[model samples]
Target: MGKEILDLAEWKSTLTAFAKERDWEKFHTPKNLATALSVEASELLELFQWLTAEESTLLPQKNKDEKLRKNIEREMADVLVYLLRLATVLEVDLSKALQEKMAENAKKYPADKVKGLSKKYDQY
Candidate 1:
């Protein structure tokens, strides 16, 4: 059997229910959610600290044991959850925002001009 798929609305509803159940919605203001999202992102980054680039890329390999991989997954989920919560509280449409940002980035970093380059848009 395949895993269940959840759309953004479903995720938002689930998160809302979770917060409501715990009386946590009052604490989930946009500012608080953004701060929590940043903290969670930092926690995720800490997992990769001091690792060589290749080691960081290989962290989820089965042979490496599940503990580190699980920690990474948990931290990533925390970051995503807080981000979603923040977006919901702020009434931001994340899908549309991401698509618009991707379009803007494409214009800023055109493949023909910026291929294989790591410079910022203005520097390229």
Candidate 2:
């Protein structure tokens, strides 16, 4: 595989190029990106609206339910695309920021008290 880029600058340029190529820059203002993110997330959630969590998990694998899986995949892509675009617009270092936030959360909720538990950090 080609070298992976972690720099936000590279991602921003990539997003800019994509927008320009498709004449989409006019539609990608920061406000529009935020709105798109919410819309895409709603579409993803619509896939599981009537199903319980257990049913939703199994629906993808049942022969009769492959359509649900396809819907899930499409909505997921929609969400991801807008997320990437939003991240680029905001110049967020997604990987580094995520790792740092996870580390902070680990300190806030240590393993000894939080293992197999769903309690809030303050409850621990």
Candidate 3:
């Protein structure tokens, strides 16, 4: 397994250093990042929002917009920075905990039972 790693502040500092290396600080202004985040998030949401049951399954297969695709990726990166910054401030370990939680959830929602099911765990 990869090493268990990265204090929150470390991730934040690393991200800041990366941005600085590329002179991305000006482009990464908090407000602009926030706006980009919102726009990117909207694109991700557009993937599923207001779709019919069948359409939900087909959306990803349908033609995608360049703007929406780029926005979604950009926004997700923006969100990650803010999240990392917050985690740094709070001194939390995001990656390890997330991996553990996902493992726990997979056990709870096993593929054998959930493969074709839509109801939540409580409903299942």
**TM-score of the candidate numbered 1?**
0.91
Best by lDDT: 1
Q: Each candidate: what lDDT?
A: 0.90, 0.83, 0.68
lDDT of 2 by residue, 30-123 (tens): 8999999999999889878888989976775768587888888899877877878888777777887889999999899999889999999988
Candidate 3 C-alpha lDDT tens digits along 36-109 = 65666675677557667875565355364555556556667666776664454445687777899999999889
After aligning candidate 2 to the native by TM-score, how far in Å is the CA of 69 from where it should be? 0.6
Compute each candidate's TM-score over C-alphas.
0.91, 0.79, 0.55
Q: How big is the positional error of residue 8 in model 3, measured in Å on the Cα after superposition? A: 8.4
Better of 2 and 3 by TM-score: 2
Where in model 3 is the C-alpha error above 4 Å?
A: 1-11, 16-64
* Candidate 2 worst ten-residue window by lDDT: 4-13
Clashing pairs in 1: none
What is candidate 1's lDDT per residue for 1-124, written digit by digit as tens? 9997748777988998999999999999888998999999999999889899999888767869588889989999999899889878999998999999999999999999999999999996
lDDT of 1 at 34: 88
